[model samples]
Target: MLYHLAKNLIMILFYPLFRIKVTGKHHIPKEGPVIICTNHTSNLDPPVVGITASRTIYFMAKEELFEGKFFGRLLRKVHAFPVKRGLADRNALRSGLKFLKDGETLGLFPEGTRSKDGKPGQALPGVGFFALRSQAEVVPCVIISDYKLFRRTKVVYGKPMDVESFRKNKASAKEMSEGIMEEIRNLYEIHKN
Candidate 1:
């Protein structure tokens, strides 16, 4: 309920206020378990994609955010789970797989955290792991440029890529992960206006 309410309210409130323009809406799949991977820019990037997408995006949030009583509940309601950064957060990983197995879409930055300079960062191997484990098609996404007033937000939606194919082709785990990140980087290049 919180996800839906916050999603609708924030989009109505901040979209016009921020003048946030979204493109490539048709690229998002309407059903099934899909992974939405993008480069993390600002703190707003998560919700920006979450509300804009037509599905409830189950995502991993920093563990500290869920420590707060009031805020924790709110985050949980919105399909956000806390994952320990820099260490294995097994619980968080389990939740992600569960959501996907349940036929829900999951959102991941692949870059791991918000970029300090708002530039694309190196993506983590966990993204590749999940894609391989879940066998879900990855929807490569990019948020171009900054969020300053009148700054254009060009989102490029690339065709879904096959993680299994990469794995089957004898690509090492790191190689496959880098391959996924490279795909996102290429899309970023196109949408970076």
Candidate 2:
């Protein structure tokens, strides 16, 4: 499959340039509907996180990346879908939920965009909405690196957070989002050396 092939190729290329290291991979569920909430720091975040994960992660990439004919096709082949930034993209949201409902691993950047300062930012409420609607275990993941060539990049996957209780309590989307981001921040603080 293109997904496997691309992952392999990317690992071969990135491992050398970034000296990528990974930990807490066991936190990722071997199988089930799961959501991975990660901090966005660089464009490399996607591939780096994907390479470190044990399972395939379908990501919500920005729409601009899919504008090109060939690159768009390739991204789709690798299970990455486009999301229109700066708006509530219903189609993108629906696709993400559908993936989770089907028991697939969905990767999300709760911050919605990359942080220029490499610090975790407040997560968008959309990730919380999806967590409540799908009831999937949300795992906090963080990638620590300046993403410079030859620099070491560490990717850590934290224990999954159960949001079913929040859903039962009728927690607001903003509350759930804050919880997710808090976990990500905790992981980053612990691992960011």
Candidate 3:
């Protein structure tokens, strides 16, 4: 409820300022557990994706954002969970899996951090790990533009990637992560032109 209300308010406020354009929304799966992988370029990436997506997205936010008690509670209310960066956080992983098992959409920024130059960075292995373990389809999203105010920001959602193939082939975690990142990069390129 709060998430939708916040997203609606954001859309009303930011849409005019940013002129955000979301394309390929139909690519998002209508049902079932799914993972959304997007290239993060700015702090605004989360809101942009969350608001543009048709489904509720539970983001794996950095633990630092949850440091304060009040703010942390607010974040949780909006469906954002804390994730410790730089290492494998089993708790975060479990939370993500639980969300998927419950047939909810999970949003992930595979790079783990925002890109400084607005380009897709190397993805963390966690995304691939979750995709394989949960057997959830991965949707690649590309956000175009530098997110400057008054400029058009375009978000393109690509078709879902099958993680089951990688699992069947017994692909390594690194391989799965690279494959998913490649798809995200391709999606970015496809929309960049």
Best by lDDT: 2
Candidates 1 and 2 compared by lDDT, better number: 2
lDDT at 160, model 3: 91
The local distance difference test score of model 1 is 0.80
lDDT of each residue in 1-193, candidate 3, tens digit only: 8888999999898788899888999999889988999998889889989999989999999999999999999999899999999979999999999999999999998888889888898987888888888857789998887877899988999999877789889988778888889998998878886
lDDT of each: 0.80, 0.92, 0.89
Clashing pairs in 1: none
Residue 3's lDDT in candidate 2? 95
Q: Clash pairs of candidate 2?
A: none
lDDT of 3: 0.89
lDDT of 1 by residue, 11-80 (tens): 8866765577666667777887899888888888888888677778988999999998999998889988
Ranking by TM-score: 3, 2, 1
Of 1 and 3, the candidate ahead on TM-score is 3
Clashing pairs in 3: none
